[model samples]
Target chain A: MSTLTSPDVGRRTTGRRGAVARVLAAPLVVAVLGLVTLLWLQSIELDSIEKRTLNTDYLVDRVREHLLLSLSAAALVALLAIPAGVLIHRTNSRVLRGVVLALANIGQATPAVGVVILLAIVWRTGFTTALVALVAYSFLPVLRNTLTGLAEVDPATREAARGMGMTRTQVLRRIELPLASPVILAGLRTSLVFAVGVATIATFINAGGLGDMIVNGLKLQRYPVLIVGAALVAGIAILIDWVAGLVEEYARPRGL
Target chain B: MPKPTTIIFPSMDVRGAASGGSATSGGGVSIELDSVTKTYPGQDVSAVEDFSMRIEPGELVMFVGPSGCGKTTTMKMVNRIIEPTSGSIRIDGQDVLSLSPDQLRRHIGYVIQQIGLFPHMTIADNIATVPRLLGWSKKETSARVEELLDTVQLDPAVFADRYPRQLSGGQQQRAGVARALAADPPVMLMDEPFGATDPITREKLQAEFLRLQADIGKTIIFVTHDFDEAVRLGDRIAVLSERSQIEQFDTPAAILAAPANDYVASFIGSGAALKRLSLMPVTSADLSFGAPASGGKRPQLDPTATLRDALDLLVVTGAEALEIVDADGTRLGCLTHAAISAALTQSSPTRGAGPAAGEGVHR
Candidate 1:
């Protein structure tokens, strides 16, 4: 049964405190905190570290590259996963659904670096191979969630729509998708975090990302760069997860 | 089951001479089913078999049977939710099988026991579904939605934006009905539409629905396993045995006066006579215009109150008779205990058919 009442949904309380609370609740707070921490680290760093790690241009390029890699991979996975999940769910043949689900499972079960290495061998090393690897590694969560979300819609609701003369495609588009969006968005969040974390391995395939800094720092004994690189990756992952959380909240069915 | 001769029962309110109501349009299209049967892919026994009946436009006919007797299956077959393996279904002389299932359903309203309003949609959106499908103008759809919400006794301003989860079960059921009626379809199929609510709410909704039907006059096929509900609401009830075989199809009063078989008699339970009393309203009993009560606390009953209520009131008030009044409290006539008896005898079993012939009147 739906517990979502209209008054409680999408109502923005007005006041200074409410404004403060809204800002405090936003995911951008993590981004702000991460920036502050990074500045604090730079303030206390040694001269050698300041020359390399404190160069704003250099740091910005790496952060931009890392984001580009993760976001693109997430986009690719979503582009592929959602339709595949919907198709699998709509298929009448149990065998076909089972086979497609098994394929998705294999994609997730494979090790992240192993997938990258195999893709690198097949397609040659670069951003393309790393992207393909990242997409493969993050595929299951969105696909599985989509299937489960669509399947969980109440059968009686579907029957009522059909009885009322909604065509099959209309039922899916109007009823099933709206009802299942929250679950699907949660799955997207999971895939996004995975993509952010795994994009670090792309540096091994000569794809420039924050992984480049971390790997170089470890090799050259630049502890400041190493800590900053690792810290930045973790920060990005937290930031992306927070945004996805916002989207999921927005997607939740009203009165549920 | 033996094939009984076809019997045509008049609409419950045909005596009212309701000429303006479209339901009384004797020349309108009627729904007719002939030897309809449904069998599962692997099951040897058919789910419903040889179901034959004709329902007049604007009349409400109920199908009552035990669980798994295929009452629901028969209802679904009309909307093409469940296809029949053999037989023909026609609505107003048009073959149902020739139309696309979706198109056929768009012209029909449907309600189910679960009252499956979409959880994600606001009440207004839910009610506007069929209208939107029919491609009505936005302004027209909203106006129709507001009108229907009022018709169902819900405030459009308050409930229009509220989700299904915000309303009580009874309220949700009303919204379900509103949604079904949105397109103003000519035919409706209801499967235990009020079966999920509590008994008190069920009665209230039933009364309200009857009042609504009196106004709109659409052709309705209602399915329920509750015999009492069937008797209360159906203009005519179709009692089915296993495999959707019609045992008896007659008016509620007729069925209570004389159940066609032991199967239907057992369904009516032990109080057939009292059930008949429920069918006869206080207005049906002959009332005397005795001199206006000179007095202290004269018991008053509504003319629309049932004879059963009148009888019960007589026992409780310890009065020789009760005054019957209209909605405005204008004194209409006086109803006596003897008047209730007169109504009962007027519908005695001697005028009908029954298994236990000697038990028609205890007194």
Candidate 2:
């Protein structure tokens, strides 16, 4: 459901801080917990640089790659989900909606790693393969929310649009879609956040994203490098999540 | 699906609004239905069949029936939202079948109980939808939106920029009405436009809609299950039953005076006894003008109000007689308690007419 549904849809629907507050909070909590692991791996006398920037000595490059791959996947997923959502919603065909729902459920069930591996073996892939896997993994929530949001629109509003001389498509655009927007945008927020975190594992195959540090840090059993690499990826995921959530909060329609 | 160069529905003689307080006398709408039938692919029974009627332009005709009796299906057919499997419907003397479904709907306005407002859009943008769709200039659309908001009694500034969620139920319903009236189409189709509201709100809206109908007089075909609403609002109500066929299509007075069949009689029920009061105004016709009761200050009474309503004032004020006032509140006659009782317990609308409804001049 959209945050704007009830005017007070969530405990925190939208404000300057409320949207990103949770997103920012979760990663910090996880990272602070990860501090214990860091302490166990590194000696107390280690140099600050060795401890803090080992795995992520190249955070800037990795962050940009992770962002590019995640964003690209998210955009494609949106394009697919929105049209499918509209078709399933605006039309009276139940069969198509059911099939789409089932497909989305399965998409959601697919593990990010399994999908990456499947795509890598079947298709000639490195970056694109991971991108496809990320997109597929993140597709369901966006698709489901778009469809659900459209479906929840009051039918009376649509009929009123018809009475006002709007054709079916006009009614869908002018009435249904606008009313459904918040929920659909929320779906996009979820997909984008998920894609960000999932894309980090692509570094395992040299897909050349931020996941590289995470993989190398793990393999070498490095202390500071592993901590830094994991922290940067976690931070990037939180950032994208924070941004998408902000969009969802601000762009959400207030009521119907 | 390949484009069928020619669309399924067409556009023709756009309607000229018949605006006035009275919907019946403004637009000369003549609608006809002939053996209309619709059967879903898997359903054995038809939702509507052998349904036929004619309504004059500007007439506020209502379709009323029990739930799931195809009243809504029949309404949808007018706009071709649902196609007729057999038979035809004509609006303003033109064949409905010839027009493509899309074209047919554009010429008609539609409304329903849910009061569906576009939550993302402000009141002004929502009202401007049709005009915007037809390529009207943004300025023109904005001006029309303001005019409509005002016409519907919504403050242009307070409501125009606010989204649907901000409005109260009553305000939302009013906005819905305003939105339906935006394009000024000749024919407007409504299905339970006030059904979702509370009784008092529904009654207020019924009166407001009646007043609006007087002004817009769009060829209106409204559907409701409330008999009192049908009587209070419709110029004529088409009582339907079973498979959506009209049981009786006539004035409300006629329906109460004489039910067409058992279905209508039961539908009306004990309410008919109370409804007769609505038609019984304490007119000069009902006043006996008892020899001047030169006494205490007489209570004021509206000449057009029914005896049942007037009786309360007469009894509460302990007035020997009430000075009847016309529409302008000028004294026209004197209505005593006796006169009101005589008028209220009169038993029927007309002295000679029996309970066969659809008889007399209305039929």
Candidate 3:
């Protein structure tokens, strides 16, 4: 009987593992193709023209800044939204959930450049302002997913918890969180990808991240530089998504 | 049930053992409901109405009838989960309505058919809910959790770290019981805790619960719609009719032997004789090793066996004298055909009240 059980558990793990693997596989191929194309393009930069040439060091720094921009914001949202998400779900307080959810959606919909511009006017234009704008832009996906995942949990399971004498908080902490984790993680990945893509536009403002390379390359008509910067940003988004997939896969409830 | 030919006499191994076992920690409290009524405002009829009964503390009593007989509604009133519109339920000579709902719940361990364990908490954490609510310290709560798991026959080490979803349905139910017992409350209310399982699992849980009750001695008011379960586990079964009508409340033997009215009789359904044997234990007085056949070459059996079990032995082993031994293996008595018959017919040769065997029988 015990042996009969581990296989069922194994099959579940494999199923989720397969999903993460498939998602990662596509991004891995994309990164490799982008890498080879960049290598070939760098070999043929024509002339000492007063044009923006691809500076490897600048490119690396911009990539680092965008990475920082997306990861820090996504992490913050995940931590805050998961608990709030489950609380709303267990209470089924649609009114409260709807309010916060609308705020998050508004945050996402309020154009990224506008947010950066507004934040720059209010605060000093720097990495910190850039971080705030990125986080705000990324909020809706994570918050919405957390709410939807938690709400989707089976009510029979919740009824079971109440009947067992679990307090309201205990039910959320123990039962609801574990069950809703996968869906919430999926949402987190979506938000991270969005933040990475949107962070490129923040360079239009003085909140200089790697978006500077793309914006500078565009103005100077430096085609190679622009292509490399855009390619790097795309690669970063895919990488963050792959990493999120790994974390989520590892953390999905064992029997899920 | 069609009445069985078996009439096994109840053993005098210890006559007053079962009844006197219900003293509990304090003096017994008789639970009463006087004209209690509950209507959910817009609902057509009241869920429960004018329901009343007397339940002694430490008693293993069950409320049973058809679905929505208001047995559940009535049980919920005791803990104030479902408030009664008008009635009085006194615990230890004090009116229960005088206390707050949370206060009342802290004193009552509640279990339902769905064993709602919190999946985030470990088994130990789930078991510690009520004690911590009652302001117990960390050490005290931890110790109590371990003790409760043991009481419910779950190995603390094997179970403590696991979440509820990881457990089988039966295991979850055991954990639910452990959680309910956390505060050592005098009253435990169960709403068909075993009803969700298959018959085999349900029987196993019921047997284990009965053995646990024997040890803990809590006053349990169990609500189930299953008549067989009511007869097997209840010290007294209270039969309710549609809309909270109290048809009868008496010992299982009395309820089966003499139902209070036609409603009670219909609720009793079929197969009374074999069920009666389930209540009687085979005693040394009733054991006859060499009755009507050879006493050897049969599968060995317990002399303290219920007539229901002995019938199976008689069929398979084909031996008259199955060894009647205690767990220590001392022969108590020979289980003869006569005793099995006596137990079923509601005929007690020695003592105690019987409905058909005496004048006080319900007419």
Candidate 4:
């Protein structure tokens, strides 16, 4: 019996060690990338057009706007999509669940640029429209994941919970939600990174973000500005993903 | 040579004795199911039609039948997991149907074949589920969890903080049993609780459960398709047929001796006589004090072991006689094939005398 179980114990130990290594490695990798980008930028001779877009104040302002748009959209998705998914699950109506899932599929199927451009065309272009577009673009992953996670809970486990005299609400809160959390957290992480990528399109609607640098650089043919803009957006997305990964690990129920 | 003597062992008849006669033992409460019927929506035929049985307090009644016999549905109705379309269920003379289902369930311990220990919770938390739901204080709940883990033979220090997946199948099932018994509910509903275990583990668990039942005496409705398990663990085995029909509701010895009808005899299969022996302890037989003629350190049997065990030892070792010993391994006497046969003949007169024997058969 001990021989049979020893392998599982060993595997679990290695898995924990892997997670710890990842937690420590992510920040170090991000820092190195940031330093390399700074060195590369400083090595080049910048022209007037490049200097205008790449100044510290201009760059910092763009980064702030970019972070604000993506983070808030991801936050709103977490708040709205999870409950909506749970409500659809609770209704236990196949038709309603199917409808919501189909709508979510369509939302995801539509390209991020199309969503941003189309929303701006129909509604007025600005920060609000861009925020709405980012939210719409990232909603599907979290919603789909919530439904999938809940559905995947073992029926036997659910029956036992109910049989033990746990009320419907109690079972959901104590059993179902905890079991479903890992998958849900994975979905949230995906959407967070997705929001960071899509928030770049907000610049098209006259919203100020790192995308402004890219647009200005492209029009004026300033390679330095465009590279810096693209690199910073990439950096933010990676860092957000790393932080979400840490949160996912921390928030997961211990037994799971 | 010394003549054989009949040694009267106290509690020797306890296994085959009718539970109704000793219903007042332990924390058990009586359950009365009166003419309960359940018909699924859109179906004309009732799944469990007019099913009725009075389970005595402290009785462990086994519902043994083939699949789709509606046995599970009948048991589920007691705890209101599955509502009956008609009729009623009462626990300890209290109308279970009238009470709130959730509140009613909290008082009835429930176990199932799946042995569903929550994957996300530690063993302690899973066992503490009911106590916490009842708003027990943290200290009280933790103490109860520890007590239950110990009752199920899991070390609290080693197993309490571990998740269900880390445990073996047998250990997980033990945890499942521990969790059901956490609040010490008077009535327990077990749906083939040991069905998923392998044969060896199942036997060990059955023995342990029987010992536990002797202590707690909780009125339990245990469902199983295995006739051998029913005979071994149940005080009274309810041989069920289609539509949850009670073909025979009697003690294990009574049913094995005289099955109510052809269906029951067939359900009992080829091992009726052997099954009966399993219900009778080794002390039921006469024993001789004479030393074996060719003694060469003969095999010994425990005093508490069943006659079936004695027979197995005799056959396996090909011994003419085996010594019976108490827990201290001191020789009580020697048992032979003749003594076992004599005991079987002596028990024949009391066959079919169990409480509710041949009472619930409705053609």
Candidate 5:
């Protein structure tokens, strides 16, 4: 019996260790990638690439612009998607929910590049058009995740809250939303990463980002610039994903 | 397994203990339902029809019936969880319909079989839900949570900060009960609150629940399909049938002795005599048989044990009689199988009265 009980204790200790390792693993990988990128850039003789892409002023400006566009689009998507999902969930009419879900599906089903090009044609290409296209592209995941999170809350818990005299708003605020936080954050994380990847297309309309380097490098046949530009974009994506992971860990409900 | 060195009996005279316990903080209001009926839309028959009963303050009345018999519907209507098609409900002589549903529920405690403890919340936070809703101070709410944890026989130190998943089924159910009792509501509605626990755990919870009720004395309407549970905890049972119609309503002993109809008799099944033995305390039976048997060892029975337990002990020990003793180990009297049988067969009108066993007779 003592032996039988000992394994459970061992498993619990290992489980905690596993969680800690998971939290550390993402940032460690990103750090290693950053060090490799720096060393590889140093080893290669690419003075031309260094002047245009690796310079402090050029890299910082492009990276800042990339981050600004992606963060804005993600914020907008969250604002729209979460409430839409909640409204769809709270409404009793099947037709209404069906209609909203159908629209979301259509938005996601359409190709992202097509959405960006179409917006560029009609609304004019630039940061604004790119932001709008990114928001539309990122909407589905956030909305779907929000709906799933709210739906996943145990019905018995909702009934108990109501029976305990909580108003509708109180139930949503104190119980439902807190329980749904981790999933919602996961949705936001996906949207943010998608937005970062999609923002690369904004350079086609001269929005000025690492994408500018890639498009220019391609046109000018500068392989060194192209490599650094592509590497930087990948690096930013990984960095943002790591940051979102931290947010998710912090936002996860305790004592669950 | 280690052999037991001591036997702790179930509390005797639960009613007296309950009444005494409620004296310090008294707040129970009588409830009366007048010809209550509920019929769902498009349904041919009403779910519950012409349901009416008076529940005295601080009493635990169990609604016992088969599934889909509308026992839950009737109870829900009291807190307006369900609206009755007809009839009025009054708590403390005030019409329940006059108050808003949320307002009415604030004063009524509800516990369900699923336990429904919020997975995101700590045990203390779960218990503090209603108190916080009612705008109690943080200090007051925390104190109440601790008090309730203790009341349900859970340690506040070990459980307050823990999550519901950290607890066993029995512990979770206890926390559920504690949550219901948090705001000290005068009335509590329990829908098979311990139906999910295993047999051993359920028995322990039932015993603990009885002691808790004995202390708090809240007016409780408990719904369950288990007759044994109803008999163990209810002061009176309302046996309902299809469409929430009342078949028989009476004390467990009264129902066991004389079932109102064949339906009730069938529901009771067999072994009612043995069931009745559980209702009366061992002291209630005449245990005045003269002296213990000389020289030979005999089994001991606690005075707090029921007559049914005494009968089983006599058979198990293969003795004509056993000595009944109090907590102090002092011999009270001898309990014989004949006395238990006589007590079971007797039909005395006085409440809890039983047959008196005669003095010593050699086996």
Candidate 6:
């Protein structure tokens, strides 16, 4: 009897070790890619146009601008969409929930570049338009996650909390939220990564970012600049996702 | 297995000597529902209509019926989980509707079939929910958590820090009960608290719950669709029909011996005689000190064992009689099928004689 169960224990130990390796693998791969890009750029001689965009100062500024746009938009979505999702969930109104969810669906369904360009066309081109467009594009995942996370709490668990004399608010704060955190965090992680990708479109409206390098390289036919810009953005996306993954792991309630 | 020979024996008078009593630990209070009725809006039929009953202090009354019988609705009203459309529910003579629903619930223990231990919280935190709600000190709450885990037979050191998912179904159920009893409330409302477990686990849980109730003696309203569960665990089984109508409310032995109507009899189902044997101890029968049969050793039963257990042992061993032993394993007497039958027949008169007759034998 004991021997029959021993393999399960061995498998479980190996599975845990595999999970640790998986967690570390993303950053390791991104680091190597970043190093390779740096080495390739160092080896290649750049023309005047490529040199202009490929310098450390310009590259850093574009990366800074890119980070500012994506991070702010993700932050804004987190602040607004989550509470709104919660409020809609608490109201428990079918019509209200349905309407909000439908609007969220439309917001997400619209292409990211289309949203950014449409907003810039309608309301002057600049950083603000890109921010709003990014927020709009990424809003649905966090909002939908919050609503679904709250909705999917076990009814029996909800009832048990209420049955134990917890007020509705107490139930949400003490029981529902903690149980829903994993799914909610997953949604936030998705939106953050999405914001980084969508922020690339910011360069179209003269909003400064790595996108500028890619666009300038493409228009001027400097493949080195384009490669550098595209490589940097991809690296940023992966790194941001890795950091978010760490936060998610640390913040998740134990025993879930 | 040999087909045992049948033995005839004279009937013995064991009426008024059955096992039913309301000895309490003084932690429970009386609950009264006067003309309680609940009608959900837009639904013409009432879920529970004009339901009224008086539950004595420390009594475990079971509301037993088929599904959709409104039994659960009736119990939920006591804690105001589902407020009554029109009725006065009093706990220890205080009107429950007057108190804030949350405050009212804090004082009433509640458990359900789902065994809803919070998945994210440790067992200690789950058990401490009510205590924290009532503003108990952390030290006091932790101590109480430790005590309750021990009470439910879960080792406090081992289980207190474990999450709900880490526990087996039976352990989770124990945690659910421990969580409910955390604040030491005077009244408990249970809705099929053991219904979700497998049969063997359910039986073990039932026995543990019975032992727990005896020590704490909180006036409990336990609801279940399983009639055998009702008979085994209830101090008084309230057979409910549709609309939460009380068909009969009396001791399990009384209900088993004498069902008030066909509805209750139907709820009792078949083999009630065998069910009644469960309520009676082996000592209730007039055990003979006759010599054992010419064979190897026969199966032995404890004196505290029930007549049903005695019957089971006899059938399993295929013996005409079994020896009843004391704590030291010394044979007290021989228990036979005839003695078990006599005990059942003697207790059968209280049947159909109504709740009063049942209560007499029960007390």
Name the candidate that leads on TM-score.
Answer: 6
At residue B292, candidate 6 shows an lDDT of 78
In the predicted model 6, the residue pairs found to clash are B258-B351, B258-B352
Which candidate has the top score in lDDT? Answer: 6
Which of 2 and 4 is ahead in TM-score? 4
CAPRI accuracy category, model 6: acceptable
lDDT of each: 0.81, 0.71, 0.70, 0.82, 0.80, 0.83
Model 5 per-residue lDDT tens digits across residues B20-101: 2322254466888999999999999999999999999888999999999999999999888899899999887878887778
User: For model 3, how big is the CA root-mean-square deviation?
Assistant: 9.7
Q: In candidate 4, what are the lDDT values of residues B251-296, reduced to their tens digit? A: 7778887788999999999977777777777877888747666736
Please list the residue runs of candidate 5 whose C-alpha ends up more than 4 Å from where it truly belongs after superposition. A1-21, A35-54, B1-24, B286-298, B325-333, B348-363
Candidate 6 TM-score restricted to chain A: 0.92
Question: Which 10 consecutive positions of candidate 1 chain A have the poorest summed lDDT?
Answer: A1-10
lDDT tens digits by residue: candidate 1, A1-256: 2222355543434677976676456456666767886787767746675467647798899889889999999998899999988988888567887787798888778888888887888789998888888888898999989988999999999999999988999999989988888889889999999999999999989988999889988988877778778888888888778778767766676755
- If ranked by lDDT, best first, what sequence of candidates would result? 6, 4, 1, 5, 2, 3
Worst 10 residues of 1 chain B by lDDT: B1-10
Measured by DockQ, the strongest candidate is: 1
Error of 6 at B132 (Å): 1.0
Q: On lDDT, who's better, 3 or 5?
A: 5
Candidate 4 docking band: acceptable
A7: Cα error in model 4, Å = 22
After TM-score superposition, what is the CA distance of residue B266 in candidate 2 from its true location, in Å? 1.7
TM-score of candidate 4's A chain against the true A chain:
0.92
Individual DockQ of the candidates? 0.43, 0.41, 0.16, 0.37, 0.36, 0.38
What is candidate 2's CA lDDT for residue B108?
A: 66
| Tens-digit per-residue lDDT, B1-363, candidate 6 | 121111111111121111121222236778999999999999999999999999998899999999999999999999988989998998888888988888778778899999888887788888888777776656766777887888899998788877788899999999999899886677899999999999999999998888888788888999999999888888888999999999988888888888889999988889988888877888888787586757657788998888889999989889888889999978789888888888777767555454322222212
All models, RMSD in angstroms: 7.1, 5.7, 9.7, 9.3, 8.6, 10.3
For candidate 4, report its TM-score: 0.88
- What lDDT score goes with residue B148 in model 2? 79
Kept native contacts, as fractions per model, are: 0.63, 0.59, 0.16, 0.53, 0.57, 0.64
